[model samples]
Target: MRLFVTLNFLPCSVFPSPSFPYTTQEEESGVIANHLTKHFSSSCYLSTFLLLIMSQRTLLIPLSSFFIAHLLISGAVSTTFTLTNKCGYTVWPGILSNADAPALSTTGFALQKGESKTITAPASWGGRLWGRTYCSQDSTGKFSCLTGDCGSGKLECSGTGAAPPATLAEFKLDGYGGMDYFDVSLVDGYNLPLLVVPQGGSGQNCTSTGCVVDLNDACPSELKVTSTGGESVACKSACEAFRSPQYCCNGAYGTPDTCKPSSYSEIFKNACPRAYSYAYDDKTSTFTCASADYQITFCPGPNTSQKASQETNSENTDTNTNTPLINSTMVYEGALSQNGASPSLYGSVLGSHVTAAIVSFTVAIWQWRQLF
Candidate 1:
């Protein structure tokens, strides 16, 4: 009798409509339920039904708990990134997702002055984005850029990361403790002013962060990357410029304690405090947020050009004092409001989810014994 009942009811509730689509977390759950129904045979249903019947009323509790736990683990929220070009010149943006993350829609695209493009990413995605400057196609239809080039020889970088000497905006969405980690890094180098502003997110460290000052004009002569026309195109990091283990933070200097910031890194740090100047500069440079979209802008400030010139002029004068290279308060006032919750909150939230899963599994096991 128990076997008969198990076989009859298993097909009824376990399988769902095969037509169900999956995109968001809720839809994905529905699809999973549907898939289970379609694949399981009547005998399988009977076995499940017999177990449930023998387990009595308590069996439903664990089964339901298992489904809920599954949903919590599998469901994910997507993130959107809007790329805007506020520069006076064109910027070709390049994207490279991490090896484990899903690929984005486009790896590279052109953004003319005052243009914007939006890209959507699936949950738990991680990648870096950067701008390419002075790009042009040769007579042979080969594409290339002077700075931040991915060397793909085409518009799309595909899976290639940006070449060194380029400012980078890196992101890991839905990361540790259900929080998103983001930062603008100049550790590779600096080619242009970049800003990352989180939207619709909350976290104590969640705010706008980037190297907004144009460092090319005021870049140290030894570290400056110049174009063929004698234009300062980008700034190279101490590591890239010298390749010393002390500067690269490798070999004997691999540890954080040994890898101290150099004079060249200090120049970038003084100019852009929120951006990563060296490999170990994480405490001040990294930021976290929860449930947020992001806006990435090239040349963000209104008086960017004038400010660049002013920064260049003031660089030599403020060599002794601790004054930052640019007035961040004036440049970041309206759009760069810094406010949010701490990362610990996200950790607690994740802990609760994990606890719930463990409890659900335990309850199911105990109930199974009672039923048997």
Candidate 2:
């Protein structure tokens, strides 16, 4: 005997055509037919078919849930960053991922002289990156940095912000209106000059935004961070030097109307026209790029030849020094839509198709057993 089964689990609206007909055939001419004829009664066939169906249903329920959850989670995308060090000295890079997000490769790591590192960030990722100078690890394994220290007493920042007088590269990837917003902010002060350039992207005024000028050279006397050798290692912000309401932009000067740019902030604005001068300097400071990779170059001034020479010398003398000037490129997947409707609809249709497939396979198995 032969058996034919048809599965009809999905609605007409889900299919491309008005209806989808799935059929399966079973024949009593296989090895299972001979075994059943010789060993089992007709009542056994019914029980066997029911048991098989139950087992299949149990397996498919979890599979369906897993598939659905996978689709929902896979919608998020990644963004790439190429962080380079152009200074003659080694810089320990520190990264702080956005709130509630996970940390990347390292919260902080050593980038040897003329070295670079690449990092990938998840969708809607926001964070800040800064360079820590004059860092050392003690015999007890506790680490400390001289400038741009996060106060963690360790190489890794562990969710801490850089101390004042640290140049900062801030980013918000795949953000509002389907664009990535980034800036090289000196609001915390400046230890080094960095440039943030967007590559392979398109948007209005999507040019590079940075403060390449060495603020440490022109840093005010009261705000200078000098080393033991009396060399200025970093530059402090006006707010750091004077904690008054005018410099800090607090109290009566908290609002944008009252907090006009002072002579101090104007200095930074004049140097880096695309960076935030004060708390309310967003009009010209904020920049947007759509689906772009960013390059953050520390100490990106007129030291190209110096950096190259140092890199070559370091490579020849220090065989263990493996960090190169350029890190590998990273590709972030996923495109975030303005509204949530597109992904939701896609998940729904995909789930329905998977459910239909399970139904067809189950029906086919059941029909094949019936023939025996």
Candidate 3:
């Protein structure tokens, strides 16, 4: 006898369908066998289907908690693409960077798609996040994305927010004329500056990385420059002996990265020309030597009275004091700053700032993903 048959034959209280007419236990067994025919064979697959999907559509059990879990998982650690500006070398928080739960997200919300947000906390908080990366016995254990591509891989990038990876269309750069990135003018800071407009004159949407321009090399070259408003123009010469009368580009002062003929050609001409010093003071644009010390100062406007007094005082001051005073105009010599060095502090600062940009882009993505 089969085990199920033996169970039914024994004193068992499992209730059978009451609609069946069974005067004897043997008759009941036959009824059970007949009724089970549709389930015992290939049709048994229906039982599993019914359990998973009620009425062939609805789930047999509710998944409310799973959706909640999804929200929590998304919000927990979203910063992937991050950039910092201070030194620019902040790396994406690695497994070693976080001691416990990494404070990766900068913002608290994940938007509809590619929208991004920012958040800022004390360095101490960052330290707290950094501390957690190693101490697995502390509390929350380390987590690696299943695909191992959450931070900066093919599937993900250290973009600008803690959000889900954006679909192509969602990465709309509103108000960005089109340029993606550029090296910031050292006049501002050695940095890879973010672009706000489509760089190509065509104004078409940017699709690739070709839009960025490196501006860090702008200085230390012999190229003559003018900055009138906010734009720059350059005048390079062809040789060291070439006087100002033979103004064009040469290795005498500036780098030759420029492809312009060894004559006058524009470095930044698309924007407002007069605003840049290179364009305005074209004649006096050359810097003889980067080793030659020069002061970096916003020329005090003529409208300022404080500068006028300082200028008059410098001119009237005694020349015997070491710093030769001019005839009452205004020029003072101050101690050298750290930015004047062998490699120049500007290069290191620029490196750090660029690293920071990468960090910011990463953290921003993580922040948004966690928030929503």
Candidate 4:
């Protein structure tokens, strides 16, 4: 291409300049134009090189093995987190208890060293940036990953051959009008892996206003998001009491120890800053959790951290002022005069004090209502 272009330009410069002396300036200008075109074309490609610098690329073959190894280990860690937090077990409401727990043990599947099985990934892990779990060695120098990559429903979970077989579970709540959106609190990273392939609403970009976007982003106030579509997300409210370095899954206070963010922090802040609630869900136009369970109980959450501190202080004051009076038997005797005796001053004035105390007690309790 260069040769041809040079050939055309040279002839114009040579032939026209030599044979037609009057055309010398025109040929010179033509030569400059040709040079300028080539220069601009080269400059235009600078962006391509800039892209190469901005995007990372390496000896990928060597790193592929490393990435798979990380996935194997991360996958095991993921499974551990999944069961304890992401994985759901039935709970006794109001009174906190895991009465309805998963079976203690089961012999279903295990991955051995150098062994591999094809496995289907969770709803997340469906984008160009995210990598799928591969059929590789398991962590702990023991077993391998799924026989094939994660996509098909073939592989089994591994645990470095030291851990027991993993148990998977899903947690979800129904929405008002029965329309459902996956809970951000239940999934691993709010099932962020969904963004990779088939899980990410199938490559659909969720925005602030579009219906397609609302399918995932439209959380209102009256309806909060805790669990969703068989995945674990953030739901700390029902679980957290007051703030003490508690970790939240997505929006709700999560299982006591894990903290996973669903998307960019700012994006999450913009959509949900105060809490993950039913009213916060813009879909139904409410700002709270869908289930009464989200509200009826006084669950602790991010907000509760500060609120708890205030409650503790108030409780201490109440204990100092009111508990002694209630504990005093002297007051009880004043209420029940001895052997039908005539009303005494102790009974008359003290009885009036008790009634006044009850009224004051009710109002004091109200001062602490926000803690709930």
| RMSD in Å for model 2 | 19.3
lDDT of 1: 0.68
The local distance difference test score of each candidate is 0.68, 0.59, 0.20, 0.19
On residues 297-346, what C-alpha lDDT tens digit does candidate 4 reach at each position? 11111111111011123222211111111111211101222454433323
Q: Candidate 2 on 1-372: residue-level lDDT in tens?
A: 223333333333332321211010001111111111121111100001112234234222223433333333223357788888877667888887765456776788888767888988876667788888878778998887878788788878887767777877877665433456677777667777678888766556455777765566466788889877676677777777787667766667766777778888777787677776665676777666655787888766553212211123443331212322221221111223335433233344355356545644665565455545
Error of 2 at 159 (Å): 1.3
- Over all chains combined, what TM-score does candidate 4 have? 0.18
TM-score of each: 0.71, 0.63, 0.16, 0.18
Which regions of candidate 2 fall more than 4 Å away from where they truly are? 1-76, 303-372
- Winner by TM-score between candidate 4 and candidate 1: 1
The candidate with the higher lDDT, 1 or 4, is 1
lDDT, candidate 4, equals 0.19
Give the higher-lDDT candidate: 1 or 3: 1
Judging by TM-score against the true structure, name the best candidate.
1
Displacement of residue 319 (Cα, Å) in model 4 is: 63
Residue-level lDDT for 65 in candidate 4: 30
| lDDT at 153, model 4 | 29
lDDT for model 2 comes to 0.59
